[model samples]
Target: MSPSHLLALRPPPDIEAQVVAFREAHGVRDAAAVPHVTVKARSGLDDHLCWLALVPAVAAATPPVPVELIAPRVFPNGSALHLPARSPGAVQLHLDLLDALRPTRRFGYEGPHMTPHLTLALGRRDVNLDALLDAARLAFPQPLTFTATDLVWMRKPGPGGAYQPVEGWTLGSTPDP
Candidate 1:
């Protein structure tokens, strides 16, 4: 790969294992193959902090806000806007992944939903978003990297399920200059 070329990365084993456990405990199914940062409410904003994880780049990622040729608009910019407010570094990457896999609506708001989060445990209703946020932050400063070049419709068991390595598709590459 050249200086301009980006290679895909895989989440470290520990991270993958944790997500798997969370999935099982919650009995989740149909998780997108890519990774994402599970977000939770923050101190000020009624929003969640993008947690640790990766997702497939349905489209190329916008730069790390600081390293952009032309920054996309947050609102008035339309699709040109690369990403919303991100926590810089890895958190930003997770945001990008979520941005790529977000479900698009028809004849409606015409904007991406702010729920840019990776589902840790699925099918579970009793989730403390606050607690989840703290857990992710504590594990932070974790320098990890992976290329989410593929998207998959995971088939994990239901009701405290298990996710198989399901099918995957390439999603291009992102090189961190």
Candidate 2:
């Protein structure tokens, strides 16, 4: 598929550790599977408070492609919907972070909206949500903790609303009041 737009992120080392810990704690080792404790949706996730940014971006950029998400959860779903895309004061912080880190956009920010979340999975019209739920239940039955400290800007193959970041923001850093 063609590349998507750009998204900035704040990936934390602890969050990565936590995901691995959660996966092992749940005893899941399937490489093809997502770690437990991440959020997911059956219909789609854009409507979720954490995912308000992604749905609108998709609608604006890939309106022709229908995107569906599942229920909300608090783990890095691997997608960006529920991954805490931005903090309470992300807009200002993002600008500050860029200045702080000298982070480059890589791909300029161009989307209907900028949503940041810990993505778990992507939605498809033909996906069987029941199966997804079953998988999620077996993996993460409880919540896990993670921290955000840095933002990662990635470059996709295309422009405007195509690409996404893993996690947007977290605690224990320069955050909003």
| Candidate that scores best on TM-score | 2
lDDT for predicted candidate 1 compared with the true structure: 0.33
TM-score list, all predictions: 0.35, 0.36
Separately for all candidates shown, the number of backbone clashes (residues 3 or more apart, or on different chains) is 12, 30
Among all windows of ten consecutive residues in candidate 1, which has the lowest summed lDDT? 40-49
| lDDT for residue 34 in candidate 2, whole number 0-100 | 31
Give the C-alpha lDDT of model 2. Answer: 0.34
* Model 1 Cα lDDT, one tens digit per residue, 1-177: 111111122344665665556445544343322333322111111112121123333323433212111211223322211112233433454345434434332223222444223433322245443454344444332433333434333333443443334434344445223
Top lDDT hit? 2
